[model samples]
Target: MISACGRDNVGSKNTAQASHSSADAATRTIQTVKGKVQIPAHPKRILTDYYAGELLSVGGHVIGAAPLEFTNPFLKDKLKGAVDVGDPINVEKALALKPDLIVTDSDKNYDQLCKIAPTLYIPYGTAHNIDETVHLFSRIVGQTKPGERLLAEYREKAAAGRKALKGVVAPGATAGLYEITDKGDLWVFGPNWGRGGQAIYNALKFKLPPKLAASNKQYLQLSLEALPQYAADYMFLTSYDPEHKGTALKNLRQSPVWKDLPAVKEHRVFYNDFNTFYPYDPISITKQIDLFVDMLKQNAKENKPGQGQGR
Candidate 1:
């Protein structure tokens, strides 16, 4: 009887070891500073901290998304069915969902998030750089594709958009972008400041002010009274609020120097949908390029009748 009891205990121990080994083999685990994160063979519930809209467009269904003070029309219209988990700092709400995987903007909250579920920290890049943002999201959502086919296809689309834009942006035309603030201070864009400006410049190939090439990599700052310095052949203005329309346009028009600038003189200041003006991925950029090209075409048409005709 004593021998039989010892054999049973050994057999039970062997069975436990074998079960653990099989489980380890079946799961895919990634090591990070937070520890090991195991990826389930099939993940069903997904929660995203940012870029929830991008994930949905790429065929992933998210159960929860970070809350916003105001809904993004682009996201609100499409994700009517998704639940808002309040915000990035809303731990209680996020915990209630019991997600299978959590996707965040970076390694922030790594320790806490890893404890909740296997988390993938995607780098969205800084305001000046979006290469990391585009690439990371592409991989997570499977935009890279089999044999890099999807990437090739997306590249083709971007190339085509650039080609189409070449015919429209007039020779010698210069442009500037502005971000309006509540204090009425205009944060002029530069090559290294915002993703919107960088992507726009990449697509339109517009002539940039010499100041953009300086060490600052940012354009000159000015009071509303000094708006003339920013006026050029073409100007794109962006604001977070609809109310800024009257104020932004009025400020530029009333300034004596601003009113005399070539772009302002020609009424070339175009307001953009504050949200669509920026992009997170190539597809978003392509859409904005199409809008810019159309604007340039219209400007050319309106100016054609007076060209070389004299006033």
Candidate 2:
């Protein structure tokens, strides 16, 4: 793992070494749609659970993130004195902090978290949506208007970014989101109903394979033997770590059928940020789009004019 306190960790976790942070008695009170939540006006000893990304976007540093709760390289480096608070549902460690305020989505065990601190539930999309999440979280932090503005800027950027990639992407290129497991299980993402695949398709308006229309909200199983049938113009290889430097990728490459797919043969497979692709949020979605554009642009450089695709 990358050093958690290095300059590269964009999301800083140095709660103990915070330039400015206060204890519960010195915190400020924030009023929100849910209710008033008293926070250490400028808490130095903050604890985060499920919504670390949400908090990071709103300038909130985490003293804790769940063990499995992944953070990017930027966040990993800055989290000094940070503790792995366990998963969002783990009430035991969460209660020990006696945190002034806890931020999370509604899907978590709110009742238990509430007992530990003045918990704030913003729902799943709030952390995912560009504006809604920032606005809601900023309000919880007692700085609503700024959060609103930031979200607006993000939307503007997202729109501009999408428009920039429109013409560059080829038309009618069917795409699929592949969920690969350590156990060799394969799950294909369906149409744009919900989930990361939907979020990705929604932002860029990418086309889906016809067979995926009825495959919403569920994983479509594919054995190694049947990998070729589901191959599309482009396969968004997700849920794997590229940093492992050929760890999972090496395993996938060794699959006999996986190595023989048309997309693989054509070198049309691209790795995606696994963290966001599994269960997505707007920030993750936008980030993924940006990545897609980067990869697409790279692909364009090598392909003949008529070889590109989109849908």
Candidate 3:
């Protein structure tokens, strides 16, 4: 009886070891900002601190994400099953979800996150632009083929929009983006900043006027009076209204300085809602291309006679 019992115990131990080995084999290694991490090759649940839209675009299954990420219009429907883990991620909830892979923009709580699962840390701005952002996420999810398809589609849309915008954004006809804060401060944006820059500078390929082009800043602080100094022929404006009613935007419209600008005088100024172009994702950027093209087409110099005839 003792010999029979010993044989059964050994068989059970061998089966457990085989199962553990199989589980280990199912995982694959990938390099992140924190170095190499072995993650499930087909992760069943993915949790991201930010860029949920970027992940979803590559067809990755997201289970937990940042609260604001849930609000992205471009990713709204696709994130139906995702959990909003609050402003700072709710680590307890993340663990409860049993996410096989965790991805975050910052290294904050990385040790904690890793305790829950294999965490992939990606520092913000790791990808210089939206296309690279898409490709990077695709590689992270092991969906490179789908990522290539999505990128090609984006390029096709961008190409079509850029072709249509060629005549509108003629030589010397520049586009500059600016924002008015609830505190009544005025700010200007460069080609790489999040505010419609992807569409204006990247997609439409507008001619940046001399004054606005020479400044080396991505975005800058300037007084309301200095608006014209940095203003382009086509002005794109947005208002920052986090804690107040939209009185600053109203006041800017009422101000003589705003009304006196050439872009305003010629009806070349376009006001964008803060949420529309604020998301710096490929999906949101693609939507922005259409929005920008429509605005330019409706107000294109040639479309309106005597508007820019002399220029």
Q: How far does residue 108 in candidate 2 sit from its true spot (Å)? A: 7.6
**Candidate numbers, best TM-score first, in rank order:** 3, 1, 2
lDDT of 3 at 242: 77
Clashing pairs in 3: none
> Stretches of candidate 3 above 4 Å error?
1-25, 301-311
- Model number with the top lDDT: 3
- Compared with the true structure, all predictions reach lDDT values of 0.55, 0.58, 0.73
Model 2 is weakest, by summed lDDT over 10 consecutive residues, at 12-21
* Sort by lDDT, top down from the best: 3, 2, 1
TM-score of 3: 0.83
For candidate 2, lDDT tens digit of each residue in 248-286? Answer: 556777878877887766667776656545544334545
Pitting candidate 1 against candidate 2, the one with the higher lDDT is: 2
Superposed model 2: Cα runs more than 4 Å off: 1-46, 77-81, 88-96, 105-112, 120-132, 135-139, 190-199, 225-229, 239-251, 273-283, 304-311
List per-candidate RMSD values in Å: 10.5, 10.0, 9.8
Put down candidate 3 lDDT per residue, 24-85, tens digits, no spaces: 67766555545556666667789987868778778789998987776667788888978887
Indicate whether candidate 1 or candidate 2 has the larger TM-score: 1
TM-score of each: 0.69, 0.66, 0.83
